[model samples]
Target: MISKKIGLVESIASKSNGLDDIRVKINGEIQRAYNYPKLTGEVNIGDEVVLNTTAVELSLGTGGYHFVISNLNNMESNFTPGGHIMKLRYTPLQVKVDAVEEQESPYHDAIEEFESLENMPVVVGTLHSMLTPFVASYKRNNPSKKLVYIMTDGASLPIYLSKNVDTLKNKKLIDSTITIGNAFGGDYECINIYTALITAKEILKADVVFVSMGPGIAGTGTKYGFTGIEQGPILDAVKKLKGMPVAIPRVSFADQRDRHMGISHHSLTVLNDIVNVEVNIPITTYEDEKLDVVKRQIETKELDKKHHIVYINNKNTEEDLNYFGLSVRSMGRNYQQDKEFFDAASSAAYYLMEVCDDSRRENY
Candidate 1:
């Protein structure tokens, strides 16, 4: 019952890391399509391609692009060495990956050795864009720290879709990556967030961990209908594992929507009602008027009672970003356009530094 269509490749827009963003002509209509070269091989113009058009037909946000299922011109498949555990099962191109927690996995011993996170700082954010600022800020302050990124499957499935990850990895801003759930193409593939956390602490020896989805977060403009709701469960998992959960609040004054005006409804809803465990929510210092909106939201939602609301000065976040030569944009707004959003992430990073310093003092 899944909607599919056969199209002709009109042109290739861009190609990177075995994925292609291309234009296809279907039934005399031009449509955008994503082609994974590893699956269907490199597609060329005039090639007939099969596409999954269900999402595009429904006009779903963040799911508008059609996926190339097969190329009539290329009918070869490549099977690589991985575990028997499959992701995107029952579908074409279902991949077998070596999940670290699996009994037959080579990294299985690492999980047994892992007992606790040892209060390792884990920064949880709702949006993918938050990863850059948080990691950039933390790396700028703690240059020697080893940071690991754990990406959940709440958004894009392939880690290659994230240019930020590519940039951060190349620049050594983040030490490694772990993709969880149906998401694939990380340095290491994990079955879920829990194992990914353990891998970060035990095997990767991560000093700090950043958890978020890849780019293109889906929102339905209704309560509990957004992809960002995953933040609640991620925070719970971090706490359940004895890791320090530092939440990156989504604050934006530049946004035109009222629900996301001060502290985003996404963050507020997750902290206020969804997450059961207490987390550290960091708010960057802003003007009293701007800060008032956040304070009012906290009071209205009683987030203060549920979570630890910490105020931090993140005025130097821009400098940290510039120091790393990193430029980030969220919802089409640049750092200057969305200062509150970036600062909120940076503040969480700053709080992690405080946690690390406190732990070091205790050890000394």
Candidate 2:
């Protein structure tokens, strides 16, 4: 029994005319017998026998050269004809833009105005972060009576911080502003920011909810929570809220990796697909079992207003985080390029909420 793997001959040194005298052996057993008219047998066993190799070309294959072996006479004699054969074929890839932006309702004219020349929205990091610029930006374009920031965290912390900077709490704006956020954990903490506002039906129940995955300390700078993998628990909460998410572009791109497993499911969008998009929320526990559940949530919006309150498994590999950060920096021109896209998407959502506040008041 010959157990040796076969090797294809590419070329031979001599051009002796013996078209049917070629012989090949494996483990002392003859495997192939053929003749090459222009090839000589005066070569060592391990010598590279260059043959007329053919390239296998087909669609859906990466464009690269591959050698081909066939049992044809004079196969080792046609190097010039077979060596340059192209093996792989090429196919074009397509990308579709799924987002769209629309104009604000005229109702906003009653409560506020927009920036003089800037159509883009302002950035508000979190409740505890600076409020002056966001609030001032809104007020500059609109009348005071109609201007307001819907509160999420019921605590007076945002108000206190604002007062410290001489921006008095506009009692009227406070009244108009909507408050959302679960004093206790709820199904959709982020959605609660909206549902709570909608439940009030107040003109400014919610302007925007800055979402961050938790179990980490709440503070500004590079230390806040809500990294990529933490998405699972937050998304579980969202599933219960009957609300969609507003994911940023970078997050969307990363989430695609897990789409096949259904762990990174749900291409959620909000505000007519202009503000936010909810993409891949990771698997919490026994992720393999929950794949169908995640897929169900993504494929069909079967679950309604049932918020699922969950505690985040705060364990994270700091090494992985650092590695991802390094990779992002290496792939892009700068770190901000990776972060900026998501930031802009979030800002768009905030702008949508700000504009909607004015219109909601007119209808109220």
**Best candidate, TM-score:** 1
Q: What is the C-alpha RMSD of each candidate to the true structure, in Å?
A: 2.3, 27.1
lDDT of 2 by residue, 280-347 (tens): 22222223344345435544642222221121121222222232221222122222433322322223
Candidate-wise lDDT, in order: 0.88, 0.28
- Give one digit per residue, the lDDT tens place, for model 1 in 1-364: 6799999999999887757999999999998999978666789999999999998888875757899888898878767886778888888678777788889877799897777877788889989999999988899988988999999999998887888998999999989999999998889889899999999998898988999999889888998899999999999999898888888888999999998999988888899889989998888879899999889999998999988888887788899999989999998889999999999988888887665774542321
TM-score of each predicted structure versus truth:
0.92, 0.25
Candidate 1 wrong stretches, greater than 4 Å? 27-31, 57-59, 358-364
Cα displacement (Å) at residue 349, model 2: 10
Worst 10 residues of 1 by lDDT: 355-364
